[model samples]
Target: MTLSFKSLGLSEACVAHLDHLDFKTPTPIQAQAIPHLLSGRDVVGRAQTGTGKTAAFALPMLEQIDVGDRSLQALVLTPTRELALQVYQAIQLFNTDRRLQILTVYGGQSVERQVSRLRKGVQMVVGTPGRVLDLLGRGDLKLDKLNWLVLDEADEMLNMGFIKDVETILNQAPAERQTAFFSATMDPVIRELSAKFLRSPVTVTIDQPKAAPNRINQVAYLIPKGWTKARALQPILELEDPESALIFVRTRRAAAELTRQLQAAGHSVDEYHGDLSQSQRERLLLRFRQRQVRWVVATDIAARGLHVEDLTHVINYDLPDSLESYVHRIGRTGRAGKEGIAISLVHPLDKRKLRDIERHIRQKLEWGTIPTRAEIEARYIDKLKSRVQEALTGERMASFLPIVSQLSEEFEPRMIAAAALQMAYDQTRPSWMRVEPEATDDDRRPSRPSGGGSRTPQTKSRRPKINRVSEPSSPSRS
Candidate 1:
């Protein structure tokens, strides 16, 4: 038997709103964590990002808010501004009754505007740690009436070096408030933080089955000793021909460089990272959702909170440093019981990291070889054949028959058909296949190169010195 939100003892109003949003059955995290949260118990929920953990905590928190008082009754802290906005929007959808005033605070936006809204008395606040702490320090944000405190994506906060800021905010909040800590992984630091903060919290962990979810076909291609990942990625993309993909890279520079290279190769790709402005991010997201872009190259920080429906594949162009990050990256796909693909490009040096990921996910990644040129051509021909078969059965075939007949009078009927098919195939072929450039020594450069230009003896181009600036201990809301 399947369990529904109504069966979980949620208020009829909440159930009705959920039904209106077409959310009928409860996900495992929601089913397990919602009850304890509604009962005013601190909860430690361990689940992947796309497992509906946001609603698990948000829905119940919404139910307990004292809308009449209009004091900030609930506070939700997130690691990134993207997630902060996402959570705020999700809560608004659940706020069908319009009983609670909700506000989202983050960096990169006008602080004065947020301060103005806070003065107007919002019942709930969702924000990144830095912005939340800043408002707290200014005495503009009060938690005296706060009844609930939620630390969403706690592990990610630690990764972003915001744990100290999170601790400060937690210490400042009312000690009696209900606290919830949600994370994708339970490393020692997270466990210690939960122990220090949550008061005898009921722990709810939703572990993925030992076997990899059947819906996701996990595969990895070992990069050959002489080839760069960028060189290897082209053949994989051609073979898979993903309708939409999220390509995960390790750094902002990598994301930009990869996006540039893919674009230069005439692929519909774009970059998403902290360097983009809020409006640029929103525009790119819209394009991606609308399928204008085939793939997006992004770092982990920028990719958080991004959800796309029917995402065909997740390409780990650069394997993440941790198993948790790998799980989270692939979790973007294979959502809502839909089958998806996760492809990773692994170098020989990173085999140990790949093994660690396999151990963590409880399944070994299937080894995949880069598709040969002949194989890619065969796939393309197979697609062309399917299209030709469809055209033969369609009404449009009759319209073109007269023209074919005229050509058949001068040439063999089979020859005319072959010519037409060749034309159609050429039109649909990928740009890379149409123009194969000869390989050069420069192509073997593992890292991004400086601009191309002839240099004099006195004017040789040199790699720019990268000054590593130490990030402040305070968290970044952006």
Candidate 2:
């Protein structure tokens, strides 16, 4: 049965607001938890980062809020500044019509700004643990009158060593206030916090969908270590023809350097890193989202908390620091049921890390062959031919037909086609060029360096590929 927000006992204004926002259906976490929350039960939610958990808690909290009272009615504690900003944005969007003032307080910004916002009187404050505690100590922010408290991404807080601060914040809230906790993974510390803080909370867990988020097709490329990884990536980018792709790198310098090289190679690309000012970072992301830039080269820290929904591709220029980081990187694509693509550039040193990731996820990584030079040229030729065909079929050929007829008078159709092909090849070939063969078969499998000069095989070699396979046939087949 299709369930609606109206059926969940939301007021007509809230339902109308949802319609304006184009939120027609509730996600699983939202569906199961909203009813209990609206009825004023303490709730504990378990879900991953992109599972729509924010709306699940935010909606009920907003519905329960006393708009007439100017005091802080609801307080949401987040682990990081990025997440706090995201949650604050959601509140603003969801409460556009309800006049529910929402403010976010976090580190990485001036305290005077936060104090100013607090003084202006917001009903809800989404803040990081450290900043919230500092505000409390200064007596600039009050939680004595808060009726509801939410701990979001509790697992992240634990990872960041903020559990002590979280406890302090909780102790300040009214003892009778309704409390909720949400996390992607529950550790002993989170469990202990729940026991000590929540009052027999209603626990809700949303099973991860059977497939990876829709439209995201993930494939790993097993290229030889000594060869140019860029050569391997070029064909995949051409084949997929993504509108905008994020290329993930390991370090800030690599992000900048890669962005420059890709731009020089005729791609519209930009670099993102922690070193950029907040406004510059925002503008770079905004440009990518708007398709002004075709590619974004970013490091893990810079890419964290990017909420762009239209991203069509995620390329791991280098493997991530950890399996969890890899998952988070790829999760940026294939969001909201849109088809997305994730490609990784694996090196010899990444074998153990790759195995660890597969073990953690309980799935084998799909291996793909490197694209050959001849194959790349052929694909490029085919694409050029398609564009010529489109140009011949489309409306703007009036001036070209005469020139075509003149050319036809001197050259045969095949010769004319050859001329077109030559122009296309000259135009599309990388300005600085090399024709290197794909690495030898023995070099395809990963290897470890031994104490001696000799290389040690980590895993038993598999049957060699007779042909280089460039792409996965299907999602599950991979």
Candidate 3:
């Protein structure tokens, strides 16, 4: 049966907002969970990432929020600051017309700031477990009036050792209020928690997807021991020229450093990690969604609930420690039946992790050749030619006709066009790329040294075909 957000018991305003965002039908998680949640029943929804679970719980939670009262009426507990901010943003989007007072509290920001907002009378709160528990302990966060409670990514909270803190917050909430638990995995511990805390909750589960290689182009780039991964990424980015990308790194420090390097190289990029305050993170996220920022360097913990449409690539500057995380990181792209690319930067030490990931996904990942200077130049020229063709066919070219006509009176038309093309190429190309002297054949390709021996010029391997994929990146140690 066809089910829309409206048919699933969402408010008209919420339905209108969803419609504006081009949502036509409710995802399975939403279809099953929203109705029960709207009817004031507790819900335990089991769904993997990218299943529209946020809307499933958020719509009903907003519907019940007593916005006029100005007292905190709803509390959402996420496992990380990123998820908390994401949930808070989702609710704000739903309540855009209402301008409901909702505040997001988590660690790292000044507690006094959160307290100040709390005192100002917020109708809803979304926060991480530890920070929320700390606020609850201060007596400033009163759940005596909280009417709706939600635990987003409950299983992740357990994995992060936040279950105790989550339990504490849940215990303090009014028992008479409606509750919901949304988790990717309903493990024994999570099930146990729900059984103990929830009151006859409705359970809904969405099946895990099959192996991921079917939609995402998974490739691994082995950075040679002599060269840093950061240096190698330049050619890769130039060759790929991704429209949007998330470059994942292991630590907050790495995220910042990598972002700095990328920005210095004139790339459209920024860093996102736990170290940034909430307001800063919100501004960056807004810019990223609006396509003003083409790329973001983020840590896994800081990018939990980050979602973007038609992401072109996901680059792992550093491979993840766990197989599940590797899958989850790449899964951010290639969504909704669209194809995406996944790039992993690895050293010899990372073979085991790579092997485990391949085994888990039930497919072999292709080896990406770190693009040579020649390949990058070729791609640039190809793109420029394509752009020129587009311009020739477009009305925008009408604006440039006067310059071309004036130049034609002094020079051959072909020479005038060549000069104009050269200007365009030189203006767009980076000075470093153009000024470097031509390199030896071996130097052209960024690869491991060839066993300290000279080889015949005819013995070169064919370059891999260009197939671009997309998602968030993880950074390398270097």
Number of backbone collisions per candidate: 0, 2, 24
lDDT of each: 0.83, 0.76, 0.80
- lDDT comparison, 1 vs 3, better candidate: 1
lDDT of 3 by residue, 321-396 (tens): 7676787789888998799999888788887888888888777777766775556677778888998999999988
lDDT of 2 by residue, 39-140 (tens): 988999987668788998888887878888878989999876667888888888888445677888877688999898888888999998999999999999
Q: Estimate each model's TM-score.
A: 0.86, 0.82, 0.82
Model 2 deviation from the true structure expressed as Cα RMSD, one decimal place: 7.4
Pick by TM-score: which candidate is best?
Answer: 1
Model 1: per-residue Cα lDDT over 1-478, one tens digit each: 8899988779999999899999989999999999898888999999878889989999998787878887899999999888888899888888865768899998888899999999999999999999999999999999998899999998899889999999999999888989999998787989999999989999999987852576888888777666668777887787799999999887787787778878776789999988899778878989999999989998888999887889999999888877778888898888888999999988889888988988888887777766655556778999999988998899988888889888888999999888888888888876656655455444331321122221111122221111111211212322
Show where candidate 3 strays beyond 4 Å. 6-21, 65-71, 96-100, 108-121, 211-214, 308-310, 335-338, 393-410, 436-478
Q: How large is the C-alpha RMSD of every model relative to the true structure?
A: 9.1, 7.4, 5.6
- Which ranges of candidate 2 are over 4 A from the true structure? 96-98, 209-215, 228-241, 405-409, 412-421, 432-478
